[model samples]
Target: MAPSFYETLVERNKQYAETHNPAPTIAEQMALGRVFETTLVITCVDFRLNPDQFLQTKPEDQFLISRNPAGRVGPALQEIMLFDVFLGLKRVIVIHHTDCGGSQFKDADIREAHKSRLPDHSEIDHMVFGAFDEVEQSVRDDLHLLKTSPYVPKRISDQSLGFVYDIKTGLLTPVE
Candidate 1:
């Protein structure tokens, strides 16, 4: 029989620990010297939208990535608050991408699709899927969210930036 997904993950992790840094390196190590030096990346769950590739960071870059369905700041607020208090966050980068799945669907669709899987259909109503119609605008919106959020400190908010990553051309365009 084929290995279960969990088993496969464990096996792959074992290999990673042996071959990789097995701990934070590069950017993470550098941030240790200064408080609020760590850069927090809020990116999409899409594998093709890997922030490391577009940001010129390596696996060992050890940057913190808070990935959700659409990389929207609303959903990542909790993590951001916690990270700031603990890891001392410096920069908040919001990255949305071209041809993103988040743009393909609406929150209503997500609610309907997930309704069947839940014990109570109305339970799905409370969830936000973070869908957006336009990619660039989404990034800008998230950046604005971070900038205005009272929870996000001025140190982190002032440094917040947004970008739209192009999957086809492998480029990232800043969204002002």
Candidate 2:
């Protein structure tokens, strides 16, 4: 008789919990959640990368978070901006990291791959990858899109800032 997948996972989790030790002073430190009116962070969907870790932000600092491939603000993200901005959110932080998986494919390549995988849908030849392999350009482009998007509030663009994250050095450098 073999143990089920869930059983194995549970056993591993229990073992890890038992072996893990917390930092002696970390628990005693007072953690006051950050306060902000409007702060949205848009970044890539890579599991290994976390936007907050790079930005050195507290958990409650950002009001909204939207993640996609290359962290490019597409149609869906435009809609998110409408809600966040109209509701009085103050800032939009565009983050694009180095060494992203989306950087592996070009616009044409991605379109062809999607067309092949999604045969039932219309061939996606018109879907252009606005920001290709350029991380800095991508972040800047996203900020531009958010600022210029018709769905977004006109004032939202005033406070938006773009940043590029270096995976190797863990640095968040401003784009513009």
Candidate 3:
């Protein structure tokens, strides 16, 4: 039998641990001072968009990333707040992309699909999947979300930026 995905991940991790030099542990970050010199990347879960490649991030780069289906900041606010409180975030980069699956459907479409697929699960009727109409507008909206959020500090919020990663061109264009 083939190894499960989880088993493959574990085997890969074992190989990774052998050669990779990781960034500072959370304890190291805490001992260093109040703010960590880390930039946080909020990008899509799209398979083609790798922040490491696009951002030119080396292992030593102090960048942390949090990814969701569409890279929507609304659902990731708690994560931002928690990371800021604990590890400290020097910057927040929101990167939505062209050809994004998140922009492909509306809430109604998913809700209807769910109802059709799982008719008995009435609780799935009102679920919000963070679907957005436009990709650039979504990035702008996420930047606004980070800026206006009370839980995210002014220092961090001020440094927040947005971008639209072009999958076809393999480029990142800043989103206003």
Candidate 4:
């Protein structure tokens, strides 16, 4: 019989816990200590990729936000950043992984795929290149957006950081 998804998850969690040392109780959280430094990690929406696994940071230590293609931080992401900045978050990490779906299809193809479902008057603009086109360039653009956006605290100009991850080797290299 096949294992249930929940069971598999529990097993994985148990394995992780055993490997990382179990702190099953909330009292252990106090022992773990609080993470006050604010760091934002942006990555793709791919279910296979987890920013936390790469970060290897404790839970609640940093904000991990994933976007499609990892390009152009969307409105929701901006809101999170705004909240973090308000709360005094100073570091930002933008991660774009290899072989992104957003980089797989051209804008016209994407638009065409949704044209029938979307309203005729919808002002949807698609990207020209897919994930493979220019991931490095995309990371650069997103970094600039976070750095220059009026919503972000100006003090973060020199402090925020960006990184790119290679899914193949599971390696993370700095973008800036």
- Could you say which candidate leads in lDDT? 3
Determine the backbone clash count of candidate 1: 0
What TM-score would each prediction reach against the true structure? 0.81, 0.70, 0.81, 0.69
Winner by TM-score between candidate 4 and candidate 3 = 3
Writing each residue's lDDT as its tens digit, candidate 2 over 15-82 gives: 99997766334233324333336577778888878776666775446456778777777744654656
lDDT of 1 by residue, 1-176 (tens): 99999999999999888876555554866687534357889989997876776788754444788899888999899888998888767788888888889999999887887886875767678888899998988988888888888888888889888888889998878889
lDDT, candidates in the order shown = 0.83, 0.72, 0.86, 0.65
Worst 10 residues of 2 by lDDT: 26-35
Stretches of model 1 off by over 4 angstroms after superposition: 1-18, 24-36, 58-62, 116-121
lDDT of 3 by residue, 42-79 (tens): 88888988888888986456788888988998888888
Sorted by lDDT (best first), the order is: 3, 1, 2, 4
In candidate 4, stretches whose alpha carbon ends up further than 4 angstroms from where it belongs are 1-35, 74-77, 125-132
Off by over 4 Å in 2: 1-36, 85-87, 117-120, 128-131
Candidate 1 collision pairs? none
Candidate 4's TM-score reads 0.69
